[model samples]
Target: MKAFCEEYNIKGGIWNDSNFRAILEATMYLPVTDKDYRKWLNFFFENCSYNQLLFNRIQLNEGTENKMFSDRDLVVQRLEAKLLRYTDAKECETEYCLKLTSVFERLDLLFNNSWKKDVLDLITRLPHEQYNQDEINKKLSFIYSNEDCDDVLVQIKELLGLYDFETAKSENKSEIRELLKYPHYYKVLVITGTTGSGKTFFVNRYIKYCLEKLKIRDISIIPYVFDISKVVSDSNLEQLLIHEMADLLGKSVQSLEDASKLLSYLPIKICFVIENIHLIIDEKSKWNSLISCINRFSRYEEFKWLLTINGYEYYALEDISNFLQRYCIEKNSLLNISKKRLAIFQHAVNMDELNKEWHVVETILQKTLSGRMSNTYVDVNKGITTPLEALYFRECIEGEEWVSSPSTYYEFIKKIFDWKANKLAECNSTTVQSTVLVIVDCVIEKLNCVIKDSELNKSDLSCLRSVQLLSSTITICKENFSVSYGFQQISYRIRVFPYWAAIMVKNRFRSKEFKVESITGYPAELKEWLIPCYIFYNAQNENALLSLFPALKKASLLEYALFCAQRDSSVFSKALYNFIIKNVDYIKSSKRCYSVFYFVFYCPLRISQKFKLFTSIAGKVKEFNLLNLYSRVFKSVVHTSKKLKQLKKNMLELAPCDVLDINYINGYETGEVFMHLSNNEEKSFDIVINDIIAYIREHESILEIIKNGNNSSFFDFFIRKCMENYLKSKKKI
Candidate 1:
């Protein structure tokens, strides 16, 4: 037996503590020697005793009992178990050494080797076997050498910047409790609200509630807020996810596969609160990965996902797409919270619970009232709390100075006009100033000039800067564009602001002293130039009669007045008639007389009323010889196929001479000669002749009277001449 033992333990003696310790140290290096194995065997053989009685009870059958005992197999199996235990211990020690080396390397990079020895000693004393590399790095990343933690804390407080007296929603409270108790019922919950309506604030409160009330693991809660505008521009999905995970887990997930594997085996429950999730619409690929991960890991029964979105955009998208609607929980929790907060603010302000704010509210109301502005501008109703409203209310209580002051009502009016003009300016970048000047000129000069692109230039547009010389101007309403209509074909329309003409009059000449008398009795050139300006100003101020007379350029003034006569004829018809009759030569020579006549003849007035006004004005005008005006009216009536009979009736009713007047007879003769020479079908005398023939046929009395009259030779000669001329003109054509 001694010789056999010597053969096994050749390098070292067995059955001693020194040999056992040597074997332990050698196992750190692999491939142990026979001497070491024998030493381990000898140590166990001496220390451990075998149960011989139990082993003897395991008797084999008669035939198998003759086989060898094979004690080598038994010894080898027993020794392998002890060797495995030693290998595991050594592996753990090796892993620690490797991690320690990595830590020192990182520390050197972070601190430049300063205080490395002290930190190393402190970490060595601490038990960090359970912490990961990411966890340790995260904790170390926060610790700075020369800075105090309070500085960071102050910055964090500023960034949070939430309002005091934040309203809490009852529905959110109950739902949060329900989630804590039974999270499996809801796979996703979405919180939505308007911009600046506190969607993010509400979600933050919910997260705080969960953290304070529930006992979720500190590492398992992840809160990610996304900015849609930035994400849509960049479209980088992996970087976004990696950064968010790194923020939460103190480490980045390299790939979805790695994340899936880690999340699959994690025993703790995880709650992911994602805000501004509408940004996911930017990257469909990232959305697929995130949604798939949620779906797959949701079966773990420990994962919960919560999302927030802008209800304004979300509901609009939901109408067209089911992607987000599938995850929508139909509840007005956001609105409820808003109402609650508004109530709190209202109560605080009304009851003086915050401070004395009644004086501030009263001051705002009084200033707006005195300034002739609407009082509803500052009215804070229920179910809405905006940042502006909050600022106003808070400042009122805190006694901060209000920005706007009193005694500048006209300045306020000017500010409004400036704001509107600036807003309209944004539509056409190159033509903003030109467009604004065109509108301003149209209102100021009272000219009905067509808005032609060819006529406008940069020089005309330079007035915009002069108009905005005041610093208080800002852009107001949105702009609108469409096609212009008229005889000219303008390609685009510059929408004249609603109440623009009225507002212009108010801004320039709205004072009570600038009455219509100032304009009506003005000089001829000035009155003619201010025609368009007076139109709107008079319309708004009920001074229609005061601007009716024309001192110079009667045709142009009459043309504009005739155009608007149908709208308000009380101010125009009498003056226009007197002007035309008094200045008959101007009406006859003016080329635009036909247009003016067309407007007046087609104006929406009773035929009898028109004839009365014309006769009254003509009789009153001094030296108003009716020959030239009557000739023009007669010639114009011949051209108007529709209103010819109406003019004839008006002439008969007003003259009292019944076609016997010498001026009318001469005018008729001239109209007949012109009609014969022209032979134009549009202006043909056939309709007129047929109508006259019909009138003669209907009134046989008139034909008999003419036949028996003493002036029958003149009538016969007129008839024969008219027939001959009509036949001759027809043959020539």
Candidate 2:
């Protein structure tokens, strides 16, 4: 600061000049000092990313847009004229030549990063700036993450072709975009996928493709996306559409005629996006009203609809007209793990997991990037024994576990009860202790007990959504990535987490409230099979479960049970094994031996069953190709795990525990960890867990991911990793 000012002979201190932005801006161009330059650059990158860059691009110079900086001298001339208008030009060049060169060198690295690429990409977009800058950014903000290596629109086809869309239904999964522009089959495109399946992410990527990359240039493609999940439930669909369109156009619209007239005045066609259509489809009136509005809008050439629906609710819409159904894309939850998906997910959750994220990304590409598979299983009831079943388990694991799979994110929706949510909406109305208690009440109590779909069928949840891995934010401290992370809320919809989270929550708290005795009546979830399945699979003994929900031939109960086994493998394994044994005669007579064998193959068995089941199935094993099933199950497990070897190396860097807590552990036969093969010494993790218990006991920001994330839900995963690390250190492998 002193050198530049002294050399320039300025009269005032740093804070003396209120209008020194251009001076500061020019200083950013030059490396004033080694440490100072990095600090400024980090601030510049963080602050200027999407908000202020476009505005400055125009303010820097107007005529430069048309004139080519054909020579290096010309760019320098322009920079001098705009950035140093108040300073003497001859002195600027002569005095700061070395500093100027360093600035140019640093700019090279910046351009190679996404910001400069975004500018260059926008420049190439032809029709001479016909695209509105705000609208373009508005669309990109939803789906665009610079973290994605393959940000191009065509990368979406790699994800689309791997699903059960109408195009791939009669055939195999292929890499193709559902909204085909060449054949012009695009109209009211309904992208359907399970909860954890990435629908909104894919839709936004496709939107970006349409806005900036789509090559059909004869007509201007105007794209608009709205998350109507909050407002769509009770509101009139027709009036709401017009109201939204009115707001977009900045005009008053009282009727459909007014909206149609406004849209018709515009030259370009509107690709209007409606998100979370699943919210309304459950109500026959709302779904029919939406479909009817689409029918009406199809008559007008002003706008077209692109809607998203959850797969849990999509099955009810199967009876819609064939023409519209052809455009319906059933998102395959099977084959997806892009370089972009992994990077964005890692950022969103702040989960680098031993910094092996990209290594896992590469492995996934080799497996699914080119070759395609049939994605058939939707829910977990499909059993873990068959090839498709194994594929389903691999693709559908939820939360941080599914971080490596294809991720389709839309809104980083506010948890209805987070401190941040309260800060933004209500302001100091809720305390941190109350927030954690709220989560415990909502997740552990509300969820673990007899929860029905009818209870959840309200317009909005009184509590935050609990069935997901918590969302995270990156913290900056004038250096490389920081270890500190912030979480929005903890949730687990990566397979609805119907299996593990339910079982884990019950055992961690050890509540009789969730016991099998409370299984007095089933909820509407029996139709959906997620919530009821979660409750039923939690039975301590086999009799309560078998008596409550039996695996009838075509009934959904068996599917629910299989889902439990696949997700909550350790807990469900013994119960499923006993149930399967009890129903062995019925299963054999019904030709359901394949599902039984699948359970035997992957699920953890009681030591007694492990030996006895092998003896009982010994004759049938040869007839059923059980050897091949064993190979497939293990192969799928290896594929889903993100390089366990590297993770094991990093997970247990902390000192090995002398005592391990039973509640914090899984996959063990008993509530104990042996130090040696002789089982003479037992390790206890009380020392390790006590610190966290103390923190959670004393800390008020207990559920806040930034303050107490280390002791939050992820601690369980951390313990599991540490256990693996400890096992590796002991050469247990």
Task: Assess the local accuracy of residue 368 in candidate 1 as a C-alpha lDDT between 0 and 100.
Answer: 27
Query: In model 1, which regions exceed 4 Å deviation?
Result: 1-188, 207-220, 229-235, 260-309, 319-325, 332-388, 396-733
lDDT of 2 by residue, 332-405 (tens): 11112233343212211111221132232223322432333212223222222122222333343322211111
Q: Which ten residues in a row have the lowest lDDT in candidate 2?
A: 405-414
**CA shift at 539, candidate 1, in angstroms?**
26
Candidate 2: where are CA atoms >4 Å away?
A: 1-205, 212-219, 224-394, 397-592, 605-609, 619-733
Cα displacement (angstroms), candidate 2, residue 101, comes to 45
lDDT of 2 at 169: 30
Residue 678 lDDT, candidate 1, scale 0-100: 40
TM-score quality measure for candidate 1: 0.25
